[model samples]
Target chain A: METILAQLLNGLDKGGAYALIALGLTLVFGTLGVVNFAHGALFMLGAFCAVAFRQFITYETVTLDPTKLSPWGAPLEIKTPMAQIWFGDFGAVLINWSVPISILLAIPVMLVIGIAMERGLIKHFYKRAHMDQILVTFGLAIVLQEVVKAIFGANPISQPMPVELRGSADIGAMLGLTPGMVTYPIWRLIYFLFSASIIGAVFAFLRLTTFGMVVRAGMADRETVGILGINIDRRFTIMFGLAAVVAGLAGVMYTPLVPPNYHLGMDFLVLSFVVVVVGGMGSLPGAVAAGFLLGILQSFASMTEIKAIIPGIDQIIIYLVAVVILLVRPRGLLGRRGVMET
Target chain B: MNIFYLPRRDAITLAVFALVVLTMPIWLVPFGAAYPGLMQKFAIFAIFAVGYNVLFGLTGYLSFGHAAFLGVGSYTAVWTFKLMTMNVIPAMIFAVIVSGLFALAIGFVSLRRSGIYFSILTLAFAQMCYNLAYSVLTPITNGETALQLTINDPRVLDLMFSERGAGLPSPSLLGQGMSGIEAFYVVAVVLLIAFYIAQKIFVSPFGMMLRAIKSNQTRMHYTGFNTRPYALTAFVISGMYAGLAGSLLAATDPLAGAERMQWTASGEVVLMTILGGVGTLIGPVIGAWLIKYFENIFSGFNDAMLHHTFSWLPQGAQDVVVAITSKFVGEGWQLSLGLIFVLVVVFLPGGVMEGIRRFSSIFRNRREPGPTGALKTSPAE
Candidate 1:
């Protein structure tokens, strides 16, 4: 029973990340009616942003000692700003902060990238067929992934957790059980909490705010929104940006869970796309619910007992769920009627 | 006079195409020096693209998961080798039939939705198949992490299998060992025939209905024509073509992997169709050939090739040229593909074939100036 509980907790952590990313994806896909294939790339960029900032912050310079200096060692070198802040007191004390700070930086950067992508590439696709939009966005994704690879190389870049939170917390000990059992990483717990918070905030903003209300109205009927003089295009573009930032922020927080890589975006893109579909194209809450449900289901499928019975069950779980759901409920669990329907 | 001029241009074009296909080995001999393996790859992909074009170009439904059918065909062919004999033709036929059935199932379900929903449904199914192939279906897929031939595989249909590993007598010509390149040429010829048949179908009455449905399905349905059958026919035909291409790929390499059905692979076919000029009969083949050429040949040009080529130039100039060209080659090859796709979509939406037609018109018109321009102007004029 405890083991099951443990697995469930772990599943929730993973589900949280999946839900966050899917929520963002569904927002753009649902509202703007543009399948932004670059959403994953934006997420990757966000994670990479964390890595980049950390790399910058941890950039260090070594001063050569006359007695034991290497043949090629410089006498003295000035470090960058990040190094100065993170590596103070002549390397005696090192402060390699957690990924959260970099994630904070990613929001604005992602928003900017989202807006730029919307204005530059995706805007032209609105009038085109979904096929064209998919093609162009796919091309854009390739460009984005390639650009990252060219700049950062294909190697997976690690984003280390803070020294203080390096190891897992003993939940077992806390619960009057044996020590060192039921261990969960602090960073992962924080990620889950953070994702839930973001998801809540997005939902709150949409449910409560006038901008979101107008966007929802726009989603139902673009012409109606336009007739009301809401500047639907600009709003849609901003929504694209918001979606990008959401995906990016998810990526940033997720760096501690899964190291940021160029192809990470591609990996997440398909599953998130499935989530978007299963959640119903334009339903925000639906996306969140489906993402978590699928994530947990997938996690359960990876159990040893389940694997013993069914080979590759873990890999195909989400897809099987998707197929069944699609056949049963073509519009998804909460999809808005007539949105991208035949 | 009408008899003498009865679409002489179409006949001439057909003859020229046939002639080029017949003499490919001779014309492409020089290219073998630079790219030994590419021409064959070009032909194989051309078959796949042509098959994709049948559904996408004529029917106007853009399938994002066409590669799933192709992969299905390839896997079926490879399994036929393992279960039955090494005779490629039987395997190819089985592949087409199996993939056709698979397509029928998927299309029946997915075609219920139109536009983006349909595309997404197909995509989801393809992804599902890919995931299953990669993990659970590994036993049937040879259990090899990467698709490859193995010696220990059971040949249930091998009548001559011996515990002593005895040599059997030589088989007939059809079952005899043929080199990979010879096999490729055979497939290429078959593809050319398929392309020609597709051209005929495009101009046929059935083809007209498909196009009509694409323009407006509601109107066609209201007019009392069953649009479902036409669309389903297009889907099945395209699926079979993809399957045939897949079987050829397996026959050529004798292995199949799930990667063939990746969304990216599906996207590649779509890009090929769009880049070559959607709705144009020969455009897909041209597009596929171009992409395969770049993917296989251009990417293989390395820094060493660059350094050798620019050896005569001054140091700085040579470095600059090498740097610029390096982007088109090496790990950055996908950049070129992406750039081409974006450029073609944004600037020349009609695609490469359209670009070629326009360019040809310029030269053809320059030869005979105003009177012919007026005389040859299409109906839109």
Candidate 2:
């Protein structure tokens, strides 16, 4: 029972990431009628934003100390961080919270990237074949990945989680079941809740706002919405920006869980696409449901007993489910009847 | 006989293509790429791209997991080497069968969806194969160290024929060594044959059907035709071609690694096909050769080479020039490829073939100007 609960937590955490990425992908598809292959690049750019931010904040200035000499007979070098030197304790605190605070930095950067990508490149391919969009975006993705590799090198850079959230929590004891029965990482739980809130915010924004209403209407019937004399095109561009922000935030939050590598986006991009397809193309709720569903199933498949029964099931369960769902339920779990069906 | 029938111009084009491929070692010397190893790879990858062109260039189905077929082919060829004989003919045949079956299964399900959905499905399936090959199928694939030939109890055909040798046996044809220049000839011959088949398919009725599907699948379906079978056949045939290429890789060097099956390798073939010119006979071959050249020769340039090349400039200017030029060469060749691919997709969708056609047509038009000749690149002579 305890094992199942722990695995459920793992599932929820993984599902959170999948849902977040798929949400943005589906949003772009639904709103702009585009299949953004470079969505993964946006996720990668967001993580790099945090990496760059941390590097910027804690950049060190070295000085040779005349009073202290090193073991090698050279003068001892005193290194002080630029941020902490300028801002004192406040700067130190800022560096400590840089991972989470980088969200602020990631948002604006992702917005400009999203808008520029749409206006400059994606805008022209709107009427081209789907293959062309895929090709161009794939080329863009390779460029982004290689550029990041050139700057950051090929190795994964591990981001430090805040000291306060470093340990595990016994949720079993907190829930009054058994002490130390189920211990899960605090950041993982936080990640789950963060994703839940983001998903809620996106849904609420679409449900409540007039702009979102127009956007949703446009998704339903683009021509009719355009014929109504509204500047739906500009709104869709913003929607693309919104999707980019969501993907960026997901990448920012995910850094502590998995080290940010140049290959991270391509790795996640494939899984996220499978999730979107299984959830039924252009179905937001379906994407989320499929995300969590696939995630939990993956967690369970990795169990010892499951591995003994069907070896390597954990590695391939998500893809297997995608294939099955595509074959059996072509519209996906919560997909509409006609979206991308043709 | 009907399949062999080609128009006079296309027949001449085929003969010229064959001549050029067969003599690559001689012509490539000027570019310093005349070595047998690089020449062998040129022919092998050219075969891969030509086969790939049937499905992608003609049909427009952008499969993203094609490396899985190639990987399977390599694995099968290696296994054949272990279980049967070191001869490459049987290895190639078995590799084709296994990869063809693999493609059949993948295409049956993936072809159900078109556009990005199909691409994703293929990608997912290939990733699954890669993962399994890395883990559970380690016995077959040998995991990270790679599947290789070992001196063991197997090789049933060789055992029946002669006494066992003390050392590892290399790939050969009927006990004749098939390494170095021989391997290049074998690959070149395979490419010429594959090119001929591709040409036949390009002019066949089925090829026209594939083009129709590329232009408008919905209209084709609405016209009471089942296009899935045709697409699946193309997919399987191309998969076999990839297998042949993979087996050739193993035949040259008897080792198969899981990394060869990665999506990145599959993407490379797509880059080759698109860069050369989709749906053009000689385009994919040119694309493959160009990319292979770029990957091998362009990336070989180092800081010292760059510095030496720019020595005519002043010391400070030479360093600056080397720094800038180094990015487009060496490790950043992929960036150059990406930039070129993006430009092609945006401005020149027809790729290098289109560029050549445009260049030649301009010369042709200056001599004989007419409205009817705009679309055709007739011989200047």
DockQ each? 0.39, 0.49
Model 2 agreement with the true structure over B1-381: per-residue lDDT tens digits = 664688788799989988898888889999999998899889989989999989987777889999999999999999999999999999999999999999999999998887777888899999999999999999999999999999994999988888899999999987778789988998899988899888889888999998877767878888999999999999999999999999999999899999999988999999998899887888889999999999999889999999989999999999899988787888888888888888887877888888887789787776543222111211010
Extract clashing residue pairs from model 2.
Answer: none
Off by over 4 Å in 2: A69-74, B1-3, B314-317, B366-381
- What DockQ was computed for model 2? 0.49
Model 2 per-residue lDDT tens digits across residues A1-342? 888998898899889998999999999989887888889888888888899899898899999999999999899998888888899999988888888999999999999989988998898888876777788998888888888887887899988988999999999888787889899999999999999999999999998999989999999999999999999999999999999999999999999999899878888888999999999889999988888888899999999999999999999999999988888887788989977663
Task: Find the candidate with the highest TM-score and give its number.
Answer: 2
Name the candidate that leads on DockQ. 2
lDDT of 1 by residue, B49-78 (tens): 888888888777778889999999998987
Best by lDDT: 2
C-alpha RMSD over true interface residues, model 2 = 7.2
Cα deviation of A129 in candidate 2 (Å)?
A: 1.0
Q: What local distance difference test score does each model get?
A: 0.77, 0.88
Tell me the fnat of candidate 2: 0.65
**lDDT value, residue A66 of candidate 2:** 93
